[model samples]
Target: MSEPFPTIRRPADRTQMILLFIVLTAGLAAGLAIYSSATSFITFIRTASSALFLPILLSLVLTFLLEPVVSFFERTTGKRTGSIFIVYILCAMLLYLLMQFIIPQWQSAWNSLQADLPRYIKGMTNYIRDLGLKIEAQTPFIDSADLVERGRSLGKDIVNTVIVGTPQSALRLGGLFLMVPLFTFFFLRDGSRILRSCISLAPNRTFEMVHDLSYLITKQLSHFIRGRIIEATIIGIVIFIGLSFTDIRYTGFLAVFAGVTNLIPYIGPLIGMIPGILVALVDLGIGGQFWWIVIVYFLIAQVIIDNFILIPILISRYSNLHPLWVIIAIILGGNAYGILGMVIGVPIVSTLKIIFIEIRQYRRTFSLSERLPESES
Candidate 1:
């Protein structure tokens, strides 16, 4: 009996290989199907989420950004709701004062811009035409009559966009902004309970993991928001100060544009810098020493401060996102939601990544973790 050889089991390993092959084949099929339907899914999601997207997103971000302030006030007043109200009142007053100063200056700059837009457009087009072999010569294939008609149509559009678009956009934004205070109020007042109620839908077995993920994401996301505000504020103030030292017209306007554009992540600097450069080119023409010096100094100083100082201090370690991913996110966000998308994309992606990592870690720690009911859990 002791000498008898034990049976070697080859079926177990073979069965596992077969099962893996089936699973991989199924996954490939599912992936292909998903790729095929991606456009429709995106359209459905975009349409469905468009209505309350900004409102909800803004509210959540404000709530997170203001959390530390709220907590500090809470420690003083010993009441969460009262602290939220206090923060809101302070915010409201600040916004009112800021808007009063900004709106009038912006209006003057806008009117001035409307008067100069056609000249800028003409100069830019001439500059474009000068760049032979660079633009692929689409203008030559097109008839002069067609070009003139298109130019007129474009000019009208430009005028309308500048004159009509700005105020209309501001009004639309104002209306959207009106919802923030109300949403922020209720959210700050009862956000924790609301979040908990949502999380309570998960099964008991996975409650800890879900809760931990939420906490990790919330903390990081809030930090990201605060860092952005601080970074934008610093850059804006610095730009304004630098531009004030220049002979450039509309320094206030240019500085404001620069700062506001900073909210759009990597693409923001180029956008913000363009108006100043254009104005300089139009004002001083090409090869003006003053224009070159001012633009170069302004851009370099801002870049040095932001990349070396503000970003390293505020975002790099805290955000824990790769530069490549940040760029990708900005592109995707811009494509999906324009400027606002670029602004919020990093935080959203960071939050999602943190959640995924936490879930993965939990599963890796326990071999049988996947045995639990995923949906119920």
Candidate 2:
């Protein structure tokens, strides 16, 4: 009996196969070139859109945070506009209090730090010198004086850079603060209608899938943002209360900094503690008990409280992503868009994961349906 399928044996068949291979290789090269161009174009577009639409983007984020409250108020009042106005009033009062109390305190602390910069630098130099002396005792080649000088120069450079950058940063922030509220108002008012309109654009074949996907993604994003805000607030309050017991200068500012930085997973808490440690070293000396206190407190608050308690309850349940993947996402995000990228990376990755799972399930269902007729026949 002959084999059901014969291997290629003819010269012409071999020539045809070789030609097919060459064609495929050329087509693949062309496809890769096109993909590369598309990627570059997408990057350029993203950069432009980020710059142009930052306020709108921020407003959308704010809408996500405040929408539930708005809806609750709307349910009670039976008026969306009235609910939004009420929320706006409440926000204004909160902002006023922040301006009256927190901003001044933070500004005063900042000013004090600036006024005492020279002293901090001198203290830091002395700390480095003392530490370097011990090292020098162990290693004769170590130069305490050089170490002290380098530390002093680094301290001065950091202060100078911060001083130089503040005005530009403030101006940009002021613009954002002004624009975000206006955009947020519109988004809060029309968000549902907008979402419905977008969903309506999907074809009937995929309409149900699109609708479900949209709801799932939106719910996930809203939960993530609100949970993060709550987590940051809790962390900030805890840090502030903890630091208030110690003689740390700028306790509130440091607490706020820690809370904000806590948004970036893994590395954020570490960075948040830098200013606190530097401040402690300046105020209480390098070898003081307060140094240990600050370090221990940060470790407990950030690593233990955040990683073990808050994250598990607030974020992990919703995302259900692995720690390794989270770290990888943070690294990629940090590389791509700096701090903003780091803040958003995990959520973006989680969204992608959801889409992938949904797609896989869809394909499996499709395949099973196709196989049913064949199996029956």
Candidate 3:
């Protein structure tokens, strides 16, 4: 039929293919081993240097947040030292005001909370017993007495845990507060020089790539950290204002708790709501008008303000993460480091994504250039 197409065949390099496969497999196994060892070494180092870690971490965060202000001041004064000094003075004043005004309210709210906690627990227990009886009346299988007993046991355990942990937590926090400013000052002063020194160590071939990667990573982290702090502050203020209208006890403390917990994504807002709702239920009866008002306020704060306005404006653009990946990262982080893991998981994953993307782009460009020469030839 039309002299048929010549059967095109190529010589098979089975022996070469086998050797190539072996080499690739061996390389992959070696790479995995090396990676595992490096990870273990890094983890060991981090654990060994754990005491120095927190202050450094907090300093870096403060540096990121305050860098723009410092930069602006530097531009105006033409002296980096003066810029940092001015910013330091401003920060000191801010801290002084916080200590004078905000701390007192928070302390008062906390003391009130501690004093009323036992009474609140007892009231909740009674409420639960009554509710359980009503439920048991409706459904014979329900055991209200057992439920009340369990609730009481849980409340007691919570109180005991808080009492046991508070002093240690306070001591650690006080030490951190003292160390963070010193570290932050040095970081602000020498951050640029340190970055250049790090980049200079990279090979010539990777020099530009490393520079770009460092800049991109730093910029991304700065935007994220600064945005999160602003977002948390705004949310705290909104919560405090909203709760002020309600009869909630410890509004300042509850708002502060909510703000702190908001660092964890997705479930953070829900976690923040728990204490407020529980207190509302204990103070103002469950299913009452005020209880409903408290729930509605939280909904408006989270769904309307946070989801619609704050997130879109501040976080969403920088994060650019898919919801599924965010959830997975949070889960993995929480599993690895508990609350701290959950807080940092997204940023870590985002940084890795940036590295992956940059490498992929570099390879693609290299491949395209190689093929262009071949095509020209």
Candidate 4:
């Protein structure tokens, strides 16, 4: 028994230790390099300012979103390329319809609001005065004269910015206008090929792992895209029908604005409401019959869509990602590449998660047991 109590020694696999160290060092170096690159002001500006990439990203997003439809076509037609062509044709038709029908109506609505700015501003001033009186009555000694003045100033700024400053701002907006669709087209066409080329470069042993990870990334992206588009379409249609039934002018335009704005998470509905409510105010004036009803309609529509429709159908289908992580990713992405980074942050992080999980699972599955000493046995 004493002889059998031999020393328990740790394995001295120098190669594995060295490899691990090398890998860790390489990873650290790569991370630092990326951080440095991202933090560079010039790089950030260049990426943010580039109009060319936006369209490609949009196209890729649309492609990912429509990939399931494309897959269905592929399965039916037995041709991936043909399905891709069909998807593009569909996209082109949608864009053409927007340009032909939607944009003109939106422009007319915007122009009508711009033309009636003075009346809206006057109504806003009276509303502020009424609110001030209510506040004064509630607090007795406190006067809301300063608050009313501030509200008036803000209203004036809003009107001036919209009517006067819009032309100058259009220059900046034009960048996004050109970039999104341009980037979207190429991204859709070459996205799969790019993924394939990337996977092919991985080490042979890791090839299967990479392939699996890639598939997972595609699946998640596809789900997110499809879910979001479906949710948006449903919301848009519902809002349009509701507005139409309620006799709200520019219902189609408002609905489209809401649908498009809904693409942005958390803040989108609020953003969409800004233009819609503002336009409604201009159209109906302050004391008009439609004013309160329209406001109530918007509030109810938003509540129902956000809670019952959007959350239930779209976001609930995905894994519950931590809000904290999502915020961090957005901030980091915004700093790294501005709007594009912000747009792609969640998807990129999700893809990375897939890769990490795949690697971890691979290790767990492939792990071998160590041999024990004979004496110990």
lDDT for each residue of candidate 2 in 162-267, tens digit (9 for 90 to 100) = 7887898799799998889998998999988899999999999999988877776677678777788788888888888778777778888788888988776666
Taking all chains together, the TM-score of candidate 1 against the true structure is 0.72
Q: Local distance difference test, per candidate?
A: 0.75, 0.80, 0.81, 0.68
Candidate 4 residues 50-83, lDDT tens each? 6445555565666667667777888899877787
lDDT of 3 by residue, 1-377 (tens): 47888898877689988999999999999999999999999998878666786688789989999999999999989999899999999999998998998787778777777788888788778878888888899999754568799879988987886778689879989998888998899899999899999999999998998897788667767877888888888888888888887777888777887887776667777788777877887777666646654654467678887888998888746365777888998999889766767877776786677556656766788789989978998
Provide the global lDDT of candidate 2 against the true structure: 0.80
Model 3, residue pairs in steric clash:
none
Q: Please write out the lDDT profile of model 1 over residues 128-246, one tens digit for every residue.
A: 45554344465566434434445556767776777777778888689777887788888888999999998899899988878877876677667777787788778877777776666
Per-residue lDDT of 239 in model 1:
72
lDDT rank order: 3, 2, 1, 4
Off by over 4 Å in 3: 1-46, 122-150, 287-297, 318-332, 350-377
lDDT of 3 at 103: 86
Q: Would you list the rank order by TM-score, best first?
A: 3, 2, 1, 4
Model 1 / residue 237 / CA error / Å:
1.4
Candidate 3: C-alpha lDDT: 0.81
Name the candidate, 1 or 3, with the larger TM-score value. 3
